[model samples]
Target: MCSVPLPRRALAGLALAAAAPRLTRAAAAATSLRSTEWEMRTPAGIRHRIQLGWPDALPPAGGYPAMLLLDGQTTYPMAQAVAQPPSGQEPPRDLEAALLVGLTYPEDAFDSGLGVDSRTRDYTLPGPSAPPGAGGVEAFLDFIENHLLPELASRFPLNPDRLALFGHSYGGLCALHAFFTRPALFGTTIAASPSIWWQQGVLLKEEQRFVAALPPGTSRRHLLITVGAREQRSEAELAAMEPRRRERAQSSNMVGRAAAMAERLAGLGAGAPQLEFVSFAGEDHGSVISPAMRRALRFALGR
Candidate 1:
């Protein structure tokens, strides 16, 4: 044994075994999700926190498609899961890789009592009966179109033509506003359980205008509107509510209104945005996000 020399094959095997763990770690790091965060103050002096994430994989020809998510604190993680599924799971077959941008507010706004106020201000349209500090959606969209998109494009390989916007609840109302007012900015728009009742169903009127004003040769767009089957309060649930709260709930009518919007757009024939309407069975407002997210990823990024 003292005089024996190891065979070349055995020596090679030892070298390979010693290097395996390092190689595995490197591979994992390369493919893992990476994010960049920063703050931007808009012209009105409101500061927003932006979080951006892109696939570790190389972008395609022009660049990666990007999605701007309102209420980023909640939706970003959901979109991230779709962009890069948890370890050992595969992403959907039709889904494409994309850059995910979370348009959120400062940490203090999120942690303190201002969260509701912030969302209300930035996600609603002005109306005769609007809430306090409401009606800042135009400014929010201005920030995204004039500032955020340009800034992100300069720093990342993003395809401007393939952009998308997503929002839920109040955020969903904002998404609908953007789709109506700035139709060309986002090629795809998804509003999950939009507060169509906002401002006395003002957006329903806006939808009518959007359809009527479609210009000839407008670029193609896609829209997906989803609502929870159980979004409308049940008879017992409504009976238990306060008088005003119950009245508000009755007016919201999330499922019916969402389907009506979809039906109207779908009836526009070839000139309107390609549309899809989905109602998740047994899901209420809060429980609908996850399943809607799956459909949203496909609607935005699917080939």
Candidate 2:
């Protein structure tokens, strides 16, 4: 069961200046719509919060499509940036009508800096190298499936068939995990800059299992995989970068691995999931989030 619901408030009014730096503009322009919050206890007894916003207009069909944003503290603010209308221009039709849900920890606000520590436990598969108390993906998913979705369904007119998920970094790894192991949970997925290097490529093992278990015929699915262009650099380019960037670019072969996975997944006969891979030029792992988030919203919410 969940705790009491809080009063709706304007996102612009929140003292989130320290919370989501990327959303400052959105926060300033977001005074038009009221956002709400709810607290729920996960099956594992961890308390988390869900922040929600509704569009000013509903689609002609009524039921709205929703995207669950992992790293909600960060992503939710960015969602505001994308969803809010700019000066003198009407908000884009599709962007204004979609539901935005942010899944975050109980005590966390957009300004919290503790997400890194919290997500290390919430986002990954257990491995020998995993930190103590880490590896709660299964339990977390269960909370979403059993508790969160039902709650959302009860309050909102959701398009049951068009659910989507977005995750980045470790959270991206989590979204990929759901894509492979629980394909029915989400019809579309956006995994940006996934930490495919985690757990010694544990998701590859899941990929093998997913293909082995796929039922005959094309399972209708859409997945977008994105990485920063700098991830795959010529030695000359790497030499020109700062030492830290050169190290990151050399260490994790993100573009190559993501492309390889797309190739292998596409080979699962004609019934496989439709996949799109994109590389954002002039971006790196950390800097890629804003562009990737915009694209993810467009893919998931745009017509």
Candidate 3:
């Protein structure tokens, strides 16, 4: 595995800050949406919060095609609004109103730096050099598979075959992690600006290995990867940064990494999943969520 150089890490942080929009107090006040949270016990004896939103009524005969959204605190409302049928459309009529589920950790989880430590532990796969406190991904997957899915299936009219998983940033990295380790877990997965650079391209290498071992005639799963037009830095910014450092940061942009991964998957012929790459113009990393959610819903619903 390639080690992430120190200069690259510094550039990544700078790029993130440069590309991220500043959230203002006024903007926070203007946004209004009430989200409900429920505590559920994972099979591992850990309790996690799941937030949900749906139309007031259900579809006539069947349950809705549900979307399991990671990082609900930030992305849930955006997804919920995007999932709603447009005006002049009937409720549960067109695409079947989707039930949005948000996954979150305990309150104290973020006391130690934006939950990065805990997330690394829970979202990464176990390996010899898997960084200390990493590889709780399997346990987290178990929680979703054994406990969360079953409970949601029982309570709602859910289309099991159409289940979709959505994640962004670190969450997106986890979604891809799950995809390589257990592709069958979800029918369709949307990973937006995933951290392929995490642990120095371990996720990308894993995808390569997964495609190599896949059997022929396997049902092609669906994966949608998206990047923003401004995701790559301007020549001016690159010029200002250290020459050696800018190249490393450029390698990690969603466009470069996602396109490479998609091409690799496509090269696998019949065994690979159906993959799509989209570039949203005039948006940056944080602002890409709204558009990505909109595109994902349309993609999942076959609309």
Candidate 4:
């Protein structure tokens, strides 16, 4: 058999047969994500329902990147099933694996369990129009950096050098706050469709402060801002939003605004960290999460 030369097709077939098991294993590891439900307590005694995800079959040792996503009820499950996307949905391939932690409301409801009032209190900045219990972002960040992180460390070996935060809408706004104020806590931040218009565009002020605080020279970190193309409203739509539009000065073109934010941050010269913006065409505010999450996770995994 060694003296005989096999046909090219036969050789190719044999090579493919050898690679099949590896392909299958990779698919299995990607699709069969493992998770555990966790109940946590904030410093103020507020309860938190959380979920953690990792590839199947883990070592007893630690040393993988970790990501914390807000709106756990929504983001948690999607990320778990990332390996099996629906037809026509093209996400990135061979996504690097990491620990995915979801910070959910303490309630039983996965959808809107946190409720408008509870979320408003926990995820927003203070302003004249802010409702009662608003401006608690600092406390929320503290909970994650101090209480939640320590607890997570006890269970798994996490790579502190590449921790990340992922959030959308108001949650996205909250993620930005953490990035600006607690830059050392996480190396990457994925803010999808951040509510920059919230509280009279106050986030821009915070962004400026964040930039000003930089000690000069290229910093180490990554920030990715994402939005849907369809979320942008035309001038006519903006006209209809009048009085209110005039009041907030927040562009109805959400994607454009995000791009502007990216541009502004990128222009901060070598002293600033790397920043990128992505807008998915034909995707609206609600339809952009999957893609945004994909890119965000890739960045966190250092792909």
TM-score per candidate, in order?
0.84, 0.79, 0.77, 0.78
Over the stretch 2-92, how does candidate 1's per-residue lDDT look in tens digits?
1111111111112111112222324533644356677888887788988887665556766668888888888998888777665456655
How does candidate 2 score on lDDT?
0.74
Predicted structure 3: lDDT: 0.67
Q: Rank the candidates by TM-score, best first.
A: 1, 2, 4, 3
Write candidate 4's Cα lDDT for 46-78 as tens digits: 667878765543322335567888988889888
Pairs clashing within candidate 1:
none
If ranked by lDDT, best first, what sequence of candidates would result?
A: 1, 2, 4, 3
Off by over 4 Å in 4: 1-33, 57-62, 83-93, 108-116, 215-218, 239-253
In order, what lDDT does every prediction score? Answer: 0.78, 0.74, 0.67, 0.70
Which portions of model 1 show Cα errors greater than 4 Å?
Answer: 1-33, 86-93, 111-116, 217-219, 239-242
- Highest-TM-score candidate: 1
Cα deviation of 65, candidate 3, in Å:
1.6
**Runs with alpha carbons beyond 4 Å of true place in candidate 2:** 1-31, 59-62, 84-89, 94-96, 107-116, 215-218, 232-251
Worst 10 residues of 4 by lDDT: 1-10
Top model number, lDDT: 1
Candidate 2, residues 1-303, lDDT tens digits: the string is 111122222233334222323333354344454356778887656777888765555333546677899989889989866774434457776653666889988654322243346677778888888767677788888888778876766555566567789999888899998888776678788999888878778888888888888743235788888888876788898899999988876767788888888788777767778777888998987889999999998888777
